[model samples]
Target: MQKSLRVGQILYTNVLPVYYYFDQPKFEDRIQFIRQVPAQLNQAMAAGEIDLGPISSFSYAEHASQYVALADLSVSAKGRVGSLFLFSKKPIEQLNGAKIAFTNTSATTVNLLKIILLKFYDYEISYVTQEPVLEEMLLGADAALLIGDDAIQAKRNSHNLHVYDLGELWHQFTGYSMTFAIWALRKAAIADHHDLIAEVHASFLDSKRKTKENPAPLIDYVHTHFGGEKEEWVRYFQGLQHDFGDVQRIGLEYYYRCAAELGLLAAPTTVDLWQAGGRQTKTTLTR
Candidate 1:
């Protein structure tokens, strides 16, 4: 008998649409789910604790040599990602030499913030990583960057302070959608468990399709578990882009280029997208 594949799942509500149906009976015996925040999941993926799952795009880029991305799955946003925010005591323009506190729960957004500040905005800023507590983060720094549920709640209760959506900022800076996370499969796992990986990828695609056809169940789940208004959850789901198609690929490649130029990555790497038939295609950087 083939062993169950270890799959990583992000604990944030933004990923619900893709994973909403993963608890179904078909997946129960074939898959084992490991839930964690993006940062932890990144570590797990790197440490070989999980075979495949969605990881920070930056994490995928950094280890592009060891993994291949699923061509049809991603966590992205075109203009405004409702849950990724940078709350500031002052306008973003005036924070040239300011201190910014970042949530320790993220890897992609942390580096993306650096790219935005140092590369795009030409600001030389210092940063510290702290727990995802906005008020506490703000006490010690001029601004705080928060992602996932923490950012959502912070923005909801926010007043007077300026809240900048990182997705929006990225879209404005570059005319491409921003892909925050990608589904990555370890190369060793793919070599050993090709059939299982294909089945899991199909399950992910099916779940996303089902969610897009009827999002009411997902919204209700978020409302019951996460305790937010259904309308807000509705808008949040609507704003997110889940497909890793041409647009998302372009955006991710551009992000890799920018990150490499900023010294966040050792060098630009090809986006090796996994194909179901045990073949992978390398997407060379356009620049």
Candidate 2:
């Protein structure tokens, strides 16, 4: 019997479309789904607990030497990622030197927020990581950064609080789409299970394509599980970009450049994409 590939699934509504088809029985024998937040999934991928799945862009960049990204898979947003937000008591510009709280469930957005505030806005702010409770976070800090479902809920109940969508801010600053997460396979797992990995990657691409063709099932799944109006979920899914195309690649590379400049990364890293027939390609970016 072939070993079941352990794949990580982020526990967020944004990833519903990419993973919608995998819940069927057909993938059960071949794939073992391990669901968790991006931060936990990143740790699992690094610890070799999971073979391949969507991981934070920051995690992939930090350990790019250990994994190969799927050439066609990512969780990105072109201009407005409806789920990622910064809820504040005051305006973003006035938050300089103010204490802020960050959700511990994210790795990529934490750094992205730092880049936005420190690099782009030149705000000298301090932050602490806390659970994804916007009320509690804001109780002690002037602002709270939330991503995924927590952010969506917080934004809905903001009640006069200032909300800034990070994706829109990023696009305004860099003129590029922001890729928050990418599907990555550990190099060691690839060495042994290249064929199986390829099958899983194909399934992911198929799932995404089908979701785009008919998003009703995806939205229905979210509505049933997460509890929101269909129209709102419709707009949310429409804003997300799942393909790792040229535009997203350039944006991701630019993000790496910014991260390196901010010392968030030790050095700039190449995005190594896993190709068919067990081949590999590199996308290198320089200053």
Candidate 3:
């Protein structure tokens, strides 16, 4: 019997379209799946708890020495992702020096929010990390940052708060897609089990393809598990870009550059996407 590879997954509605159906017995046996939020997964990957999963892009940079990105797989958006937002009592410009509570479950969105505020708007704000409850996060703070399912739910219930989609803000400022998460594997794991890594990568790609072909599985999933209107679930998946193609690569590189300049990252990191057969490949493209 082949050794099973442990995988981490983000337990959110958005990821359902990419990974939901794989829960069937066929794929489950080979994959020892551990579900977690992005932040926890990031920490787990760095600590060698999970071999590979979709991790926050910012955390990837912080742990660049330990991981290599899985090519052609990412959670990104051109604009208005509808799942990562800053809800504020006042406009962004008016909130200088105001306290903003961010979701402790994310790293990419927190850095993205800071990059948008400091680089584009020239605004400064203090931040506190908290659990992603819109009401609880908004208490004692002028703004609250929410991501994934919490953000979508908050958008539905919010009437008076100013909601700024971080994806849209990044695109408006930089004209590139905002890559929130990337599939990353530990360097040593990939080195030790190239074939297993390839199998895992193909499994994710196949899952994503099947989900896109028939969205009913995902819609039904959110309806049964999350309790939402089917159409709303459909729209949420429609807003996501799961492939890290050339355009998305440029967007990701631009994001890294901006994050490095803003001191969110130690330095601008290279996009060394993983390849089958234990090869580490870096693609160069002109933006």
The 0-to-1 C-alpha lDDT of every candidate, in the order given, reads 0.90, 0.90, 0.85
Point out the higher-scoring one by lDDT: 1 or 3. 1
Give model 1's TM-score versus the native structure. Answer: 0.97
Error of 2 at 137 (Å): 0.2
Give the candidate order by descending lDDT: 1, 2, 3
Model 2 clashing residue pairs (backbone)? none
Rank ordering of all candidates by TM-score, starting from the highest: 1, 2, 3
In the range 1-287, model 3's lDDT, one tens digit per residue, is 76677888998877665686553466566668889999999999999989999999889989888889887789989998989989999988798889999999999999899888888888878889998999998889999999998888888899999999999989998889888899999887865667877877877788888889988877887888877688988877898988988888888777788889988888887678887555778867477
Candidates 2 and 3, the one with greater TM-score: 2
Summed backbone clashes in each candidate are 0, 0, 0
Report the lDDT tens digits of candidate 2 across residue range 192-234. Answer: 7888887778778888888999998878878888887899999
Q: Per-residue lDDT for 224-261 in model 1, tens only?
A: 98887999999999999999888888888898888889
Model 2 scores a TM of 0.96
TM-score preference between candidates 1 and 3, better one: 1
Candidate 3 global TM-score: 0.94
lDDT of 3: 0.85
